[model samples]
Target chain A: MQAGGLPDTNQVSTDPLRNEVPVTALGEASVETPTRAQALLRKIEPYLYLLPALLLVGGLLLYSVAHTLAISFTDWDLITPPRFVGLQNYIDAVRDPTFTRSFTNTLVWTGGSLLLPVGGGLLLAVVLERIPGQRVLKTLIYLPAILSTTVVAAIWSYVYTNNGVLNETLRWAGLDALARPWLVFAPTNTLAMIVASSWRALGPSMVLFLVGLQTIPPELIEAAKIDGAGERILFWRIKLPLLRPITAVVVIMSVIGSFMTFDLVWVMTQGGPGRSSETLAVTMYRQAFIMWRMGYAGAVAVILSAIVIVFSISYLRATLKRSAL
Target chain B: MKRYSNAFWPLLVALLLVPALLMGGSIAAQDDPVVIDWANDAAWHEAGQDAVGEASLGVTGIGVNTVIFTSTDTYQAAVRGALPTDDAFPLFDWWFGYRMKDLVDAGLLADVTDIWQGHIDKGEYPASMMGSFGFDGRAYGLPKMINYWVVFYNKHVFAENGLEVPTTWDELMAVAEALKSNGVTPFGLDVVGCRWCSFIWFEEMMVRVDPALYQSVMSGETAYNDPQVVAIMEQWRDLLDAGYFSQPGDFSDNWEAPFVNGDFGMYLIGDWWTGSLERAGFVAGEDYGVFVMPGITEAGNRSLIIEGRPLLIAANSPQLDVALEFADYFMSVEAQTVWAETSDINSPNLLAPEETRPGHLVDLANAVANGEYELYTRYWEATPPQIVEQVVDLLGQFVLDPAALQTVLDGAEQIAQDYWASAGGE
Candidate 1:
């Protein structure tokens, strides 16, 4: 290894665990073997630097996850000592109609997020790329994304309420039939929340797409134009194909975001008109906190996490393997 | 580099040591006036603190620091998550009856039986009040406030419509019809303001239908979808069909605003909301008057729904002696009077002077006494919280679309059945 403590690639590949004698970067100092204590110190130094983060992960994140997992197998009201109920809670969760509704709503949210934010963002980015004063326009569009989730939820709740701006506008436009209590019912409530979510999400998705778009070589677009290709053809052929990598990242993020949707739905609909608009995240919180069924809620959280993890892992693995090739 | 490293150690050590020293200093000074942590979610927490200050004069060396939580859900989550631990507040507000059962069973609540015995012996509180806070033959909490559910009407609106407070089911329907025809939403069924608001009408309707059946259904002796319950839902639906309720979307976090603005002519809620109405600039006798909603049947007419909230002591309180002193002092007439007058709510301590109570409460108390009404627990605390939450959600849907009565009832029944089956019934 180099004396500056930058290990050589060959040295690392050959004997990763072995202590190496280092020559100075200028190759002036003689190589000296590390003593046993020095070798142990070298091994322990990296972990020592990592100790705070390790403690944090183990103490907070991993401990809570492990505790939740343990509680999932029991029947615990907040007040009572947990009674082990085996897989009853899981069975109950699966058989429960509310869980089924929440699961279905989560899927709808995921699909809506992909289409609304990702698809709409790409269109927006492409359009902004051609427009003058794009920077200011982009900032304005992204403003909602910078607001807190609670604020966004509050704003949307006002717009979507029964006698709210949307309904009033509809009535003014002589389109009373089109107006309804946007956050008070089933499909519409979920759809309204998705639109609100999409509005907040569009900014980041657009920025990411813009970054992707700019990375494409100018020569490529010039060549496409020289080949008698129009704007639509260029976007469909070269631009869309090259944008796949960023799209995959955005898609994964949107899917995960949709799965963990609690704040907006909670603040707006509260997963209600009777849990009709609940996502898995809202259901988990309501069960644990509002209903005080810790064990049942644990089962729900585990199910939600398992779904997200499995989807993320499989998608990421596929994307990484393809990207590597 | 060596000089920097030499200085960094002491700097980091100093940073860590300062906080440790401060914490130790605070711990050592615990012998000073003890500040017991009191957690609550009510808007009247300042009034509660005032009452605490008054009570502290009697229970020497102990003052309370009241912590406010913004919502019921957040408050319950915070309190329940910290229970059976020293980290929990030594004093916290909680609902009475079934809501207190789980906490009591877990032994997370201090046994306040002795405190109750003292209050009862002094005739400060009635023995009947103890039943709601008792489990396993021991009282676990002291009454914080008692509120009766009654309809509060705008006296001007009633007079303007040439109507009087309805005394029969038919009269109530006619009043509703008259109000609706006059283009005023006759009722405040603002299910959107809070999830629990959905249960207010469900509870009102249940007892109005039959008090015995209300008890049977709440205790899980009868199915939630039973025909009688369905009949109650049908009656509620008829009200909806008549367009007596303002749309749920018409409500917001400022739940009292629309009622205060005269958008709705009447609101049926706990008498505790009297303070909120007053805060909204409604005079007690001039702007509003309270009346029991006439029942649909003879049994329903005889019953009144009441909500009792309690102040619980943590069993693991570090200052158990101070907590006990606070609890005992809070039950005294002096404390109750200060609490009632300041908070504008009724005190369960019967010995509290009637003049100290709010005029609305006094009038309602007189009417209830004269009518010989049988008081029952409010629906929110009458059943297990799990069932209440699930059923309330279903009821919220029913409010949105009254045509889905059968579907809502079925869903409620399923939830109640699952809970009862698992709990092995009450």
Candidate 2:
């Protein structure tokens, strides 16, 4: 009957005298009993219900992804006969300077995004949980999460433009000399895009952490306080450790999202100012769609998937180890 | 697993039923019409759609369904993705050469050569525009519209700044310097979002310097980083450094914005840009005038980069005969006239009557007829796709750092050499 526990059987029974109802009638109830063949049919009925959906989704995933992998090994251009090229696509990708740049950009993007959003979200969640009007603050902070990424990118593109709102505001506040083409400049473009990415990413992490924060019992914190813990000590020693699992989830999600950062770059820069802003995903898209080199693109995609899988596995393993400790 | 069974069944059943219902609904919806899917570029303004709607009223025997995509990049991607499937649009506008070759080689494009030959024998469209649709002496598409780059300058801006249309390199430099000194940006070049814009400048310069050299580079006859190319890069860099461009880093800014605002003097863009400019509330011949790009060589010849949008029929389309008939009708003078008047696009059919021409289109026709133009296919359409990307990216980088001219040129040369070797080029 408690919120966290399973439902009580006592609540289902109206009276103790109802237990005298015939056992044979209960067995014969349409919801309960069947013959041997019917029981076997009943046992497999759920599987029958699920068969079409399983086949549809499973067949699609297998055909598309497996077909893509097979195409990656050939010299298919989405048009011509797919000549078997072995590992040429993979080899070419490694040798490509643009591909190398894209790879490095994705790494920086993934690492930087994970740190900012997950860390900031945790910090904000801990602080905001105790603040007055926490619900209002939570709603305000989480609003951007519900907006489409296209809308977010459009707003951020204007802010990042040369004479845009960001620069205009900076200039008015006596930062005139610091203003430059934010998204056009080489080393700064990636950083600028990452900032925009973090803004959109912050909301989801904050919400996740808020939910995680609520699950940590008030009694634990009270006990920590009674044990003579200061605010800083309580946070670092108690709250932080308790929020570790959620933080791991947030970080892994952020990493994957950052690695696949395409829309923001596509809408804003289109991988421009000379390929400085291209991620591996953008490169894959260009090779696949723009150039119609499907095989090469497939190779890039396979490599990207491998990287994501590795990162996710290592993250899970580390999270598990930390939780065990 | 048994403990979770209660939670799992309802969720599973709901998920399973939703798709089944949707599939049934779609199947039921398809029984009423002969759907012909026609895909068009985003650049085709609403007027084109209106014209199509009007035109389709005349063909009541056929039921047509048009899916218009606004983004050229997305449209191309969709067409490529849909090729292996039965669901690709029955007809679509595709760029010539590379796009046509790829589609034809894949056996995805219907051979519309017979239709084209029939049109040609009837003297419907120009033979030159047929160059775009033809690959290895076979036609796969019908050229719907033709476009070529011309130097479009603001006459008011030029007159106010006491500058004439430059016909030579020296005059262009002088005009640019004068404009810069007077606090006006000389040109509006959108080099930020598209590397293709920068390539236009590169090719324009290359053609002016030596058309043969440009063709050699495009056809892999010469290295992309050759001395001639380096010179062209140096010239481009010099122009940028001299303040010929309005805003170098503002690549996201539409070229027409600065031009329309009367802050920039000129825009080197294709004829198709006139539609966008008109949409932005600018008039041609009154506010702006078209001129030939200046000559870098002694010949004083003008070469315009031609890009054609060809309407192609899908090979596997069940309605192939209907599609060809529609295509033949689409390329006729009557249809082209409708296209030119309504969409404000230049028709490849030379017979498009002058009476039906839009204001700027009339001017374009005049310019082409006066022997002031020669059609040169866009480098993107002419060159290998990888080479196009490499060249464009290098040009964009050069715009940022003029000092990186040699390095960019060298990089392009390396890519060109590699491409040539791989492609078995002579």
- Local distance difference test values of all predictions, in order: 0.84, 0.77
Candidate 2 collision pairs: A79-B106, B192-B251
- Evaluated with DockQ, which candidate comes out highest? 1
TM-score of chain B of each: 0.93, 0.87
lDDT, candidate 2, residue A31?
23
Q: Write the per-residue lDDT of candidate 2 for residues B54-149, one digit (tens) a residue.
A: 575476344456677877777887887677667767788787876467577678988888878877777765566566776777898887667777
- Residue A282, model 1: lDDT of 94
Q: Considering only chain A, what is the TM-score of each predicted structure?
A: 0.87, 0.86
| Candidate 1 chain B lowest-lDDT run of ten | B1-10
lDDT of 1 by residue, A107-156 (tens): 99999999999999999999999999998999999999889999999888
Query: Which residue pairs clash within candidate 1?
Result: none
Query: In model 2, how large is the Cα lDDT of residue A43?
Result: 72
TM-score of each: 0.90, 0.87
Error of 1 at A257 (Å): 0.9
Worst 10 residues of 1 chain A by lDDT: A25-34
